[model samples]
Target: MDFLLEIIMTPAILACLKIAVIILLFAMPLGTLLTLMERKWSAMIQDRVGPNRANIGKFTGNGLLHIAADGLKSIFKEDTIPKGANGFLYLIAPFFGLIAAVAIFAIIPIAGPIGNFTFQVTDVNPGLLFIFAITSLNVYGAVLAGTSSNSKFALLGGTRASAQMISYEVFMGLALMGIFMVYGTTRVSGIVNGQNEYWFGNLVPMWGIFTQPLGFILFFTALVAETKRAPFDAPEGESEIVAGYFLEYSGMRWSAFMLAEYVSLVGVAALMTTLFFGGYHVPWLHLWENAPQWIVTILQILKFTFFTVVFCWFQIQLRWTVPKFRFDQTMGLGWKKLLPLSLVNIIVTALVILTLA
Candidate 1:
């Protein structure tokens, strides 16, 4: 019993618990909150009031109550399985998406190390590759949902989704090759540390954005497409496909899909923070190296959270601002345009590195 207690008190176990709590309390809730914010944001863009009707007594919480209301509604709502649907796959599909979305956080360092505990769940050496591997499984969720539904529209959406995700994924990987070449390591912590320096004798940050501007653009565009936002959301073209791969899902299952989307949105934002925006490193934070460790930790956490929220807002704005693309247009842009550009970016990055070396 003492040994077991000691094991439970170990740093590894504590880190795991911290990670789980952060994901559940912070990441998941933030994602759901974004759903409300998205509505309000779009309404503001369109010059309309949003979501103020959800209230308790006189306190509406300015539509903040909608998040809880939505959750309770989903819980009580009837879950319907299609008449001819594959019951097993239908039930498990949402979990695939939710898991994939949440798993990416494991490699993201939230606020550097605090004593024996790091903010990240795991410090995998091949951090970027691990992200790609896990995110690749997300396609399975859409495919399974579509195929199991036994609906033509669902299948079409699934097919388009898989193709789109695969296409953009290639560009996304290639675009980041420039960063890997510049940083010389695939570990996210290594990359973040690399960005902590200043360039031009303290005049400018040596951030990934400075070193890989073109790569940032390319990677961000590919990421937005990967998340299936507007202008690239042909897979779920609601105008044509009704509700796409999730047409048959209802209640909590449907909620799970929505949650996965928002959660994935947050995950992408965090990745963007880690890869290009300097992770938790604030500008000139090195000047405060002698500050208390707790103060530094809090500052880093706030910085990371701010950047993540900004990126999430940017994504929401992009969704409402752009019109959906046609299927052919989407395919052409991914394959003919982004893919070629990513390759060129990599080539240029390599040559520059060789010249400097």
Candidate 2:
């Protein structure tokens, strides 16, 4: 009983609980719903009915049952290993992406500090670098799956993924130079809190979107491509390379890859919210200085959730709306265009900050 109380009452334990709540209860569920959301959204964009077929007897819940149906199918379906595959690497490849996707939320907070506790699992100093490092690990899943599968299509897909990650990752890091300059810290919480300040006599919040618009665009684009979504999806070219590196996977292994994709989709949105939007901050909440802490905390969580959903919706819409770029075009955009612009953005931002200082 005493140990249980320690587990329940310790501040560190509470922080862990918050992290679990955010990732398990929030991020995972949202990712699951987004799978349905993307299909439904694409159908709407294409002027057709969305998924409404998966039903439990009389209740389909407007295609919500598809989530369960998919889960069961992945579980009950036979797991297969291709001939000539590296058995150990092939079995473990799917988890690399999943691990990376879930790890990102550890440093992400859903709200401001509440009394003696914070709404995050860990508060390391070099948080943004941690994010970059974790994100870069996602490529391993593709590379391993492709190499181990022993298929020409998967091999080609893995090659594309490696090149794509290498190109975009450069500009992705370059793009953040401006934000790091503006905030003067690599800590994500610091950056989020820095945005809470208002400028022009409190008329506007100094959001990253306003200060580093180009960086936001570059970062988000790189992140999308990193997830191997459409438009930048040459790595998973279902038509061109037969589901890319994940083509040979079946049963829960295939499901794991898909889950990683959706979770990363959510991660992208969460990163955007943290770095650009006011990150769990309700704008002008300072006006209500007398509000209860519980109320304020609730409001912050709601604000974060709202923006996250909107961004998810936007990404889904973007995938359906934009045409897929050929592999070369995708590479060209990252190296030829975004890289140069990101360099320019960094130089100009530094000069501006120096002059202002």
Candidate 3:
């Protein structure tokens, strides 16, 4: 019993718990609220009321309570598994979905140094590889959920998902190669540190977005595809595929898949924040060289917060602005367009770096 306690309560375990809680607390509510916000934003864009009907007993029209109501409503709804579905796989699909979504958080650099310590989890040297590896896991969840359902629509969705993920991942990794070459490091924290160097004069800190604009654009596009959202969301097309992979799931299981999608949204936002937007580094961070630890911590948090909000807003805007692409168009854009461009971008970046040196 004592041994079990010691193992379970280790510093690593505690750290994992804190990270999980931080991610979950931010992710779950943010996702649910964003669902409402999307609707509200869409309504304002088109001129209509959205989700104002949800309320507590007395507190009517309070947008805050709608999140709780919608969640509870989803919780108590019917739990149904299709008659022909593989019961065990069907049961596990949502778990896989949520797991893939949440796992990416492990590699994201949330903030700058807190005194001598960094405001992240393990800052593994192979952080770029880690992102690629975990992102590959996401397709499995989609494929399994679709295949195990024994439904035609689900199968089509799964096929699209698998192909789409594979096609886009190529460019996603290649796009990062530019940044990797620029920094000569795979660690995300290290990449941010590389950006700490000043360019030109005292102004213009060297961010990857400025140095590798083409790579950043390709990375951002591929990330959009990888998240299986927006213009790339043909798999979940209600007009044609009928809710895609989750067609066989209902109740909490369905909710898990929904939650996973939003978590993935947040994960992509965080990744974009870390890779391109400078993680938690405020402009002229080096200028605060002598600031106290608490002050530095606050600054880091504020930076992260600003970027987080911006990323969320950008995602919401994307959802509204971009129309869904046809399946073939998606494949073409990924392979014929982005993939080759990313490779060329890499070659050009490498040659420039070599020539300049």
The candidate that achieves the highest lDDT relative to the unseen native structure:
2
Model 2: number of clashes?
0
Q: Residues 70-152, candidate 2, lDDT per residue (tens digit)?
A: 99999999999999999999999999999999888988888989765788777789888898899899999999999999999
Instruction: Spell out the clash pairs found in candidate 1.
Output: none
Indicate whether candidate 1 or candidate 2 has the larger lDDT: 2
Tens-digit lDDT track for model 3 on 225-271?
A: 88788889977877799988877788788888888887888888788
Q: What is the C-alpha lDDT profile of model 1 across 40-140, one tens digit per residue?
A: 99999999999998889999999999999999999999999988999999899988988998998888888988766688888898989999998898888
Off by over 4 Å in 2: 1-5, 9-12
Rate residue 318 of model 2 by lDDT.
86
Screening candidate 2 with a backbone cut-off below 3 angstroms (N, C-alpha, C), the clashing residue pairs are none
